[model samples]
Target chain A: MNAFTRFASLFGAGKDASGRGGSSPECRRVGEVLQMYLDGEFDGDTSWLTDHLDECADCGLDSAEFQQLKDAISRLGQPDTDTRQRLQEFADHLAGGEMDVVDDPV
Target chain B: MEAAQTERDAAFRSYVVPELDVMFRVAMSLTRNKADAEDLVQDALVRAYRAIDRFDGRYPRAWLLTILRNAQINRTRRRRPELLHDPDTEMERLSSTKSGDEFDPEAVVIDPVFDASVRQALDALPKKFRRPVELVDLGGLSYQEAADDMGVPVGTVMSRLHRARKRMRDHLEQTGFGTREID
Candidate 1:
């Protein structure tokens, strides 16, 4: 129907679909489930991938690291409380019709 | 007071107020500066307030972020000829602040140098790939949600994340942080 439909329906793509050049016999199919595998959501055997991780240099090195990176990246920023308070005050003012649009400082 | 204005304010409370923090963080990602991020969020809220009738009463976060992102882009285009700062540079600024005893090295276990190396590799990723990582992994958005926010499909988001995580690993391995594990 569209490019998206085409890309997604390439059914047998499995591991190569990710396009990171991680395809290999042991990790080929493994790549398809790597993200889920890292999250402990994969359906099949754990040691199947775990065994691959033990044997496959790439999977061993990267799978664990990806999890760490996910953690690291998520740790980077916080919701600014000042922004929240200001937005609240702004919302209150707008709600009360106390501020005109022409003089809006925001 | 106009009835429409009162209704809009009520709608803002029901739809917009709860998302202020999320919108602020998403705004920060786009603007890379706190003041600019706050300004962008504020402006986006005003714009959203004006367009509240158009909202479907669903996907509030995505709606606000889409507005904030567009506002930031339009403003950036008007004010500068280039991106405010590359994500890599912005990420480095983030890591710099987390340094010098605040991170509690004994608690985290990853060496600070290696930690910085990991960040460098992540920042080194192409922005298209990096942005998906931010939206899905860092931003805690579902793949479909990120897809909607970025205007791509879920498959594209997954592909981007897969490639991005793969590349980050390759970079870490090259830097010899491959064996290091985080607890």
Candidate 2:
């Protein structure tokens, strides 16, 4: 493990941790599984989290809040079509080419 | 040099041009400022051109994002002096979390304050946690991909990502708007 990983391992093991199958490969917690869920990596019914989410209202709320947060974060930083044109012109100049794509673009 | 530029221009047109919006959005997610995002995207585009020869041309968006992420980091590292250590100060102001005393996620569908809350919560994360979250959550990189990009284990990525999200939720809970754990 790298220094950061080792540091994380030292200080990172305890907050809100409710893991299963400790010291085993299949071990996962609400935190880890919830990460997968937000990443769209959770295999739905096949995921180990399925059972936990069904039984734990807290985890269920965690799931919903994470989904909502993901949507919120995803909706940020939207750029219009003109942004592409502007960036392309910038790239052209950065490429040692003239700014011929968009005339007099600032 | 001229001939290589010509070839790079063609390759860039084919591979990179289509992904400008993705790069911009990813830049915005990191910078949280339109002006900064634009500047970062321009830097990344320049770096991408310089490194375009190394890219295999598939997964153009991913390739550009990697470049953009690195550019942002380098920029952050360079500008960070002892007096200006915290790079997030500027971003936090842009999101302006002053109104998050009652940040409601459900009520945030059209609320800028809720938007600020989410961004502020992300800003509050430790570097170890935030990097993976930004890579996987914001940049849409996969576990293995984020692991490789961040040079950490896949388990580490998952661990940090989940921890970061949990912390974000906890912050939202503190804001008096989101659901809190039943304890």
Candidate 3:
């Protein structure tokens, strides 16, 4: 099986005969707030979540994946040099009262 | 009058000039097109200039970002209605570049293939999901700031942004993105 199938099977292992994955309640709770925890926006106590992440391999991997995704997304924010230069010049003109505001034609 | 005009110009330079790059980045996040983003920033700057005399000069970045958000909303309202969703057009606009030769090598932190996959995953997301990601991740807005811009409550922003990232993560994993080296 490929990596994806393998990773998915790990989650699948939590399922019981009823096909309701028997993952611990802690795991379920962690899953609910993992994004907020990673984003540093979680307001409540985080000690339990941290403890759970340390003990649960599956939850740890999930956290790592989310962190990686965030890092990748952050890299796209850099503005190119030409755009910066154009904006700088425009700001100069606007501040100097050299440019007039014209409505965009509909 | 001349002295007052000079003082207004100085104040504009001091308060608004430093934020031009940030304004463009947020505009790009909202519009997802280079030319359209530039136009949006232009409009916002015009508004800022016109109102500079009345600005209280506190929390300039917040004030400027609010102006930028309003400008984007107005621009959206003025546009001709989109008849139908076109994935190809959406992808093109999301990946739009002003010049091929203007590449910045330092900006790339991961493999091009991985980055392309991430962009594709981002492109495939529904607009409601995609906007939160773009605003928070690509535009570097805090959750509260993004919430304010979208006119939604903080809790709603948190929920949507979390769900959006989860969807993107699922997409990446399905594409074997997790197998790559991550550091």
Candidate 4:
């Protein structure tokens, strides 16, 4: 499916004649929390979600697609070396009492 | 007094020093400017050092992030009142070469075209949607940490972030990336 239709299925917007546009209860549940799972923030037992993805092709594809997107975004930014060093030095100064914390505006 | 000072410094070093990188990342997301982010982190560090004696030494990341967020809020209130509403202007103030300057060298292993596409997709998001992504995806904050930083509920952060990623994913697919089926 194309992006629009695929994501539309995610929101229960459109479904094919087979009623398989992620309309199943398991798929629906996965759809609701798949991002949470991918984000490592899902709170409860995730075994069912994993089992559903393992057994179902469409859910598996969705999981992989979101995972790919998350991975891509996560790799886009980093702390530059100069900033890291500067922050380190600042921390060192504060730890060493070289900076006056009481007079500084936090 | 000297012994107490030495103990406080040791505690500050042990608790706050190791989290400098994380503080910088979260600060960058909050300020969206390299200089402002550095300043904010320093301010947060100062606050953290002052409070290190009272800190219970658990979840130091969360404690430091809370301090950083509070510092950003106070800084905004005291200095840049305009930044409270104008995300576009804030985004513009972000260094043009920020991505290039900060792109992790290890990420060079990934496809350049794909990375560029992802950046474009991210830039296209609305500021509300974009902030959560930057905090969680880019800054490595957990959902709750991002929620705390953004002053929103965890569910709200999750919803915005999930929708944002979906939009980015759609954009990537339209740009002829990540559309193929997995093996």
Candidate 5:
């Protein structure tokens, strides 16, 4: 596996050998686990929440709320509209396109 | 040396120039000023260009960022001793107040109050925490991708991110901006 997949799997987000995961202590939430969830870093194991949501409603609610907080946090102080436009333009330039320069030797 | 120079020039056109803006944004997050950011980005690009032959090309952006990060460290080392001490103090002044406001404090507010709050919080984070947030949130790198770039275990990256977000959330709460309680 490449570095990306290697690292991701190490973080408990990679696919398991079984089609579905069996109950493992690894499923428990720690600070790091909550963090990955908040960042939407999951690999979409439907079984991811099945364990916690089944036993603990509080953790499940926290997970859902944390998702909202993550979304809102991302929106805070987002680059202004003009700056976003400029950033997009810059990204496009990197992706291979020329932007119109108002003043240039040409 | 000859091979390095040739490789550098080619990388400059193929990689560095194309990714200038992305590089600048990352540098801006590090140096927090336009002039310094420009210098940092240029320095990194030049170095990356020179080292292109050694580059594996598996992840050009990560490689460049590693070089840029090293360049930033070297530049920091060369700065006058007094300036390096409490560098955050200077950055704070730059961030809290406007760019230039001689008579009126409101005339040239450096950043909007809300934006300033956010910037201040981000700047306050430790490098371990800050780097993950900057790499993923601002630099648009994924968590796994950042782990590889930062050369850390993925669990470490997640911990840093969690701590960083908690710090940011606390700062926002203290400033009465964000209402989410971090526990």
Candidate 6:
């Protein structure tokens, strides 16, 4: 237990050593799963996160934290009226003309 | 003068003026400086005007962007380089906090310091990483859209995005926030 605590403090309990307080291996694994989960990329590996989370406390915490953070960041990044207007103008400009693509046919 | 006037008048108005803001924003993301961005956008507009009559009108935004990107690249190739300091690394050095200053959780994260750091970090990246980061994250185009724009497969976009995001996070860590959760 002492050695484990030491390992946790030194290596951040499996968190990144780069000063981002490396997350646990379990957390990283969970993060990978969550990426696939949110992307809906895996219909086959349905029980991965479920079974992993059941055993990994750190991963569970990381998952919850990541979800919350994702939500917050998404809200912060949501397009505002001005941004939308800008994009609309861009779209309109795009509708005005096509670019000439030079072809090299031998 | 009449010919020039006629050409200028017909060269375009709605697109030239209306798209300026979008062009400026994209340029800003690419150049990371307002003056340079403005210059690049202007050059791109001029180039676009020259080619506008021949344009196919298939994908105007992508086409314009390609020209703008090319202009930016051209300018970079010709221009003398300026010295840049990576703010992320500097921020990391200052993370000591011996002064006991606390970062505000509610303060805007897009402040000049963070923005400059992000810009610098992004500029430090290779062109391969820079492209997807510029397209997907800053430009807010979807993967398929960017794929079409870049003439690459969607998987390539995904790969570039994954690498770019990882590189960005790594850059952030190296500069400051070493081990701090970015998201």
Off by over 4 Å in 6: A1-106, B1-21, B81-110, B178-183
In the predicted model 1, the residue pairs found to clash are: none
- Fnat for the candidates in order: 0.29, 0.41, 0.49, 0.65, 0.03, 0.00
Q: Any runs in candidate 5 off by more than 4 Å, and if so which?
A: A1-40, A45-106, B1-11, B85-111, B178-183
TM-score of 4: 0.70
C-alpha root-mean-square deviation, each candidate = 9.7, 9.7, 5.8, 6.2, 12.0, 10.2
Between the candidate structures 1 and 6, which one is better when assessed by DockQ? 1
Model 3, TM vs. native: 0.71
**Candidate 6 docking DockQ:** 0.07
Q: Locate the minimum summed-lDDT window of 10 residues in model 4 chain A.
A: A12-21
Tens-digit lDDT track of model 3 for A9-79: 55443432111112689889998888888887788899999988777766766776676677666655556
The list of candidate 3 runs beyond 4 A from truth reads A1-33, A43-57, A96-106, B58-62, B73-86, B89-103, B175-183
TM-score of chain B of each: 0.74, 0.69, 0.76, 0.70, 0.71, 0.63
- Candidate 1 Cα errors over 4 Å, as ranges: A1-31, A36-64, A80-98, A102-106, B86-92, B98-119, B176-183
Point to the candidate with the largest lDDT. 4
* Sort by DockQ, top down from the best: 4, 3, 2, 1, 6, 5
CAPRI quality level assigned to candidate 4 from its DockQ score: acceptable
Model 4 residue A75 CA deviation in Å: 2.8
Per-residue lDDT of candidate 6, residues B87-153 (tens digit): 5554453232233222223323423244334555566788876776576555555666678767899
Clashes of each: 0, 0, 3, 0, 2, 14
**Per-residue lDDT of candidate 3, residues B66-130 (tens digit):** 99989888877777768233557754543443355343455443344455567778877898888
Model 5 chain B weakest lDDT span, ten residues long: B101-110
Number of the candidate with higher DockQ, 2 or 4: 4
- Candidate 4, superposed: residue stretches over 4 Å from native: A1-24, A80-86, A100-106, B33-36, B51-63, B70-102, B175-183
DockQ of each: 0.18, 0.22, 0.32, 0.39, 0.06, 0.07
Residues B34-121, candidate 4, lDDT per residue (tens digit)? 6778898888988999888889999899899889989988887787565553545533433133454454555554444465567778
Q: Cα lDDT for residue B64, model 6?
A: 79
Q: Report the CAPRI category for model 1.
A: incorrect
